[model samples]
Target: MRQGRRTGTTALLVGPAAAFFLLLLVLPLAVVVIYSFGERGAAGGYSPAFTFDNYLSLATRGQAFLNTLLLAPLGTLLCALVAFPLAYFLAVKTSPRWRTMLLVLIIVPFWASQLLRIYAWLLILGNRGIPSLLDLLGMDGVRLINTRFAVLLGMVYGYLPLMVFPIYVSLEKLDKRLLEASADLGAGAWGTFRQVTLPMSIAGVATGSLLVFILLMGEFIIPALLGGGKVFFIGNALVDLFLQSRNWPFGAAIAVSMVAIMLATIALYMRFMLGRSGLRQQALV
Candidate 1:
């Protein structure tokens, strides 16, 4: 009787949370999945009939898919390049007195809306901004805004902090005595870092890379604002289908495809990461 009461109490505690999770996350995903396999009504939105027409419509957005596929990884790579060095400097090099201030500076931008920050980038990179400044110095016709470069730049800037904090935490937790021991064994700075530091911080690198990659794949706003609609992503295509074209079935199909692709990509990425870690361990041994 007592054990039965305990089981009931545990269920009572977990029931609401499970219900909320299903309602918020599972329900929406289920709805999208169901909508994807259905037909769009003549008046827009989902119709009762099941069909493959919506999935077939993806070919129409080929260019958008290609662009998103190519650039999202590029953006993620760029973010890692910028973030890792900055994170290392902050975590490994900076004095405690200055580190706090620098970290705060890095994080201060989050208090503002992302929309507002993207708009700010618009002014800073536009024709009258960086271009005009360059022209004054005899470097004329420097177009920065609305280009692929601008889109990549905005993505890097927007997500750099997210990329940094994880790596920073990893680096911060590193055992400095390990470095000292390596140096005593005549290992050069580069050797010590390559064998010890890099291996140790691989987790952070993978975390940041995955975070940036997955988010970039679904990015629409950066492309819309910085690409100026010229360099459209699949996300932008989905937006148009659902909102502008009112093709709910097609939009749901696109959404489901994106989710499936992301899941597959992340799984492969993890497998590669795990294999790499095992190889590094073998090499060290």
Candidate 2:
């Protein structure tokens, strides 16, 4: 009887949360799916008319899709490139005393809002900031703000901490003896890193890359602020559709498509990671 009561209480506690999620998340997603197939009303909201025109309209935002697809991956790669070495140094080389300090420093910027940090970048990269310094060096006025480079730089800066912590944890928990064993077997430093260190840290790299890439796909602010409304992305398209154009049906279609693409990317990343895991096990054997 007591066990029955306990189970009943647990179910009561979980029921509200499950229902809340179903109502708040699943129900809205279902609406989106339904609306994606339905036609826009003459007055501009969802209508009873069923059609695939919304899906077909996806091609209209091809440039945004292409830009997001290209830049998100490139930005993720750049973040990884910059983050890995710092993570490696902090995790493998730094003393315990300094490791915490260094890691804390990496994350300290996060204490401030990301929007604020990006705004700060505006000051540094603006006409009066870096351009003035360049003028002093006899360099011509360089347009830094409102460019793809600025967007990429902001992405790398914003996401660096997210990348570093994961890789650092993975490296810190790594078996140093394995690395020493590889070196003892006549492998060079790079060989040992490639064979031992890099392989083990694959999980972290995959995780961090996925996290950054998914967020980047949905990102609009940095590009909007730094690219000066010129750099278009799927996220920007969604924002424009909802806010400026107020085309919810088409926006929902685009959003659904973005979700589909994200799922596909995650699925592929998981498969690749699983294959790598199998290879690592085989190599160990």
Worst 10 residues of 2 by lDDT: 276-285
The parts of candidate 1 lying over 4 Å away from their true place are 275-285
Q: Evaluated with TM-score, which candidate comes out highest?
A: 2
Model 2 regions lying over 4 Å from their true place: 1-6, 276-285
The residue pairs found clashing in candidate 2 are none
Per-residue lDDT of candidate 1, residues 100-125 (tens digit): 99999999998999988998999999
List model 2 lDDT by residue over 1-285, tens digit each: 999999999999999999999999999998988888877667667776678898997999988888888899999999999999999999889999998899899989999998989998988999988988998999977989988899899999999999988888788889889988999999999999898999898777877887888899999888887777777789899888878777778988999999999899878877777565763342221
- Candidate 1 has a TM-score of 0.91
Please give the lDDT score at residue 36 for candidate 2. Answer: 82
